[model samples]
Target: MKIRLLSGGVEVRGILLAAVVALGLSATTAAFACEGGSCVNGLAYEAFGPAPGTGSPLLAVFVHGDVSAGGPADYMYSYARQFAASRENVVAIALLRPGYYDRAGKRSDGSDNGRRDTFQSSSNRAVSGAIRELRRMYKARAVVALGHSGGAGTLGVIAGADPGLINGLVLASCPCDVPAWRASRGRGGGYASQSPVDYLSGIPRGTPIVAVTGSSDDNTHPELASNYVAKAQALGLNARLQLVGGGHGFSSGVGGAAVSALGGMAR
Candidate 1:
């Protein structure tokens, strides 16, 4: 696996829980005009297994981190595809953050703010909106979101501010403390983005959250996630930190850890 620096993207009930563990999925994408908050279907995604409203119990959403301006901005395809392939009753969607385009050239609406001033409210709102729309579309019993790098930062905020939208969260190599990260990057004033740690009070205590970081990752260091998880625990949230062998990019270790979290949610 090619490891890059961290950067950084669904449902169901009792019957659905059974569906997620047993596993077979049918490829599906039932199109519809859906809106979440004010984004108004501004996001785009690649879906796998069971069309919307299929009664799938589990919905997993994958959001990739900041990729430079180029091809493969939506690089979570393999991860989402494999996730869907492993479960029959689950639907996985690899979402494109605002202003990002997939390999096939499908672009999501909304501004990426040059893709640097990201994880801001607008970006966070759009992502939360996308997840809301996806959940409604899938009629899922539970929703799990897996985000990496900048994507993880976004999900972290959503997991707090819009806590009701997701049941489980997997954050990989997250810059959970945005202000501190900006300070380290020499941006003394900090960007307009909202840090995940600032919004932790809103997350419910029962929500399952996990932050995974590479043991040797120089970028978005392990302490970022570890500290965030620690604070979360202080707030009585079910959160933990997982350290694995690798540099700063997504790996099979991160994927397995995330899938394991999803399984735990099912129970």
Candidate 2:
């Protein structure tokens, strides 16, 4: 439930669980699309920067991995903080994927679907919509997405499905191949989920992609990302894989890798 960042003398010590939190950006659930006669604004996000829409050199959005129902959805806060703190010209956002509610009572709109299988195309639509809204609000020149585990998988799918929307992508411990990942766990996918491998042709050639996975992660095997990168590189995309010597969970090493990917953009 706690996020740890301990790379290069930078230590993110605490979680922002204040009941009365006040960020410059909108604190309410911000949804940008509509489906079935209802507004599709179920995504909640926390941001670090000046008010949205003024101007920023880089806009970075973070999405957390899937967890059990009602689990704390703030594990990616460190990534948000790192992106924001890296440069003054950056606006970093920690987005609660559709249907996720943090302990601080902020819930993003959508069905979490038991936190096991929320990576449906419908969910990606919601996420893409949210990112578009944030980009417009910030008038960002560059957009980068940083995600871990399931969040990484979703972003990987998005990179191919929605090209030109994001300028850079960082995926950590992702199960990019949905069917293979599910079969590895002995679970049949009764729900719908898109595989990043299927969308490789959709990615534009210039976009930069970085996927980092733990050496000891059994949940989302490193080969999953490795295979995805191999294909992406073969297709002329700027994608590479970094194997971290750890587990599947987020750590400072993951945070540093994200910073490396994003810091280049800030410059």
Candidate 3:
């Protein structure tokens, strides 16, 4: 396990390499929460802002997609940077280790043979730890969680465990039906049964959540994103789904739209 402290470009490179290696056979985890320190085996995250002096009441926590940690081409970071530049406090967090999606148990055929059923729970725990740490480090007027793909699932877990920790949630390209998805993947167990929608259903009304997905994201379940929005609405929570352009990965246009939506909610 290797940790990269936020500092110069060289350290970022080394940390990225370590994250890639750890994500072997699993999804890559990247976290950016607060700014400060370099602990052994633990990377320090920093927030970007305008003029390095102005501050805002909103703080956004961004979780990266599968096998990705805010590295180059990662839209999570791009949007976070944009928000920070606009004067919103933003923290990005990478996972402690690679996530299970990128790497599952292998089969003799040399294909991706790993089981997707059990990975969701494990990833959820990892993301929860990061969230707790970020909350402690930064006490903002409002907190929003932005997750894409596998990261969105992880955020669901966090919201289920503690809904008050974040003021709102944004799930992009998320597969809502965990049991069904796992089954479709040819795994015996159904989609990871643990989903935020299930837990948030009972929360008091007025919870804010937004689900976003691309019209072309074929990798995820067809109705999962819409289902999430519907569930949130049934619970009397403030929820909506946005349709964007592109596949699974982040695109500039989609990222901008997400950032805009988040800003609206934060205000």
The top-ranked prediction according to lDDT is 1
lDDT of 2 by residue, 153-206 (tens): 788888889988888888888889999899888888586878888988988888
Could you tell me which 10 consecutive residues in candidate 1 have the lowest summed lDDT?
25-34
Task: Please give the distance, in angstroms, between residue 146's alpha carbon in candidate 3 and its true position after superposition.
Answer: 0.6
Residue 61: error of model 3 in Å? Answer: 0.5
Two-way lDDT contest, 1 vs 3, winner: 1
**lDDT per residue (tens digit) for residues 132-167 in model 1:** 888888888888889988899899999889967888
| Every candidate's lDDT | 0.78, 0.78, 0.56
Q: Give all TM-scores, in the order shown.
A: 0.81, 0.81, 0.66
lDDT over C-alpha atoms for residue 215 of model 1 = 84
